[model samples]
Target: MAAKRGGAPANKIISDNRKARFNFAIEDTLEVGIELKGTEVKALRSGKANIGESYAAEHKGEIWIYNVYIPEYLQGNRNNHEPRRPRKLLLHKREIGKLALAVQKDGKTIVPLKLYFNDKGFAKLEIALAKGKKLHDKRETEKQRDWNREKSRLMKNLG
Candidate 1:
């Protein structure tokens, strides 16, 4: 077998929704392409996008992301894109059907997890089908995280 010349290309992450995991119980995740304008793409290249409060939804038989803030490119002049426009997501018909069904029947939300540029330099959004966490569930998650951190600290000291 021939040896590969290089490893896989690393994705350049533009934004991450860290609180999404704490607030939602993620069931499934999908990588979907994003439709971007020229200025929007340039803005993202500067790594100033925010997906923390953004979410995806089925609109007119297609998936669209809302509330995502991609700041204007400083050098874009008069051609800058809107900062919080609803952007279309690119997915197959089958995938769109599945997501629509999950939202309508399963009471699940499509939450944006991360926004990044793939190895091929295409913009992508990682979205999750998730159910909102209850107050008790959130508390339990926090407690478990704290316990794991303490356990790791103790083990490090002991070893």
Candidate 2:
């Protein structure tokens, strides 16, 4: 009889905030753990989480993410977690200090870019230190994206 060969688990993305890139100029990103209830974890595993409107900020010396929506686990019944509760993010003291300083001194914002299960099956949130884009900057970004899409089409047609 052959022994079972269980390989390392793969990182699985549960949700992404695609508009974050278009709305802000990202300076840095960090992957931090999230403290979630059992029902929340079950809901996320079903790929029903949304981080599109979520943002992280320092609160009482710790970082907490707000507005992230993890729907109630249908099977959880009476023990379901809140759908839009503020969740605490886990990070090193040094990293938290850096994020806090950047937000305080540089007027930057921390936004959740993605939420996923890491290779070890633990849930992680990728947060970005970003500066908000001005109206003109946003228009320029849109123009550049349009040009890139046109260029890609031309290249594909030629090739």
Weakest 10 consecutive residues of candidate 2 by summed lDDT: 3-12
> Please, what's the RMSD in Å of model 1?
2.4
lDDT of model 1 at position 131 = 99
Model 2 misplaced stretches (Cα beyond 4 Å): 1-9, 152-159
lDDT of 2 at 113: 93
lDDT of 1 by residue, 1-159 (tens): 986467445688989999999999999999999999999998998898999989899999999999999999999888678899999999999999999999999999999999998888889999999999999999999999999999999999999
Model 1 TM = 0.91
The ten-residue window of minimal lDDT in model 1 covers 3-12
- Please write out the lDDT profile of model 2 over residues 1-159, one tens digit for every residue: 996367645778999999999999999999999999998998999998999988899999999999999999999888789899999999999999999999999999999999999878899999999999999999998999999999999999999
- Please list the C-alpha lDDT of all candidates, in the order they appear: 0.94, 0.93
State TM-scores per candidate.
0.91, 0.89
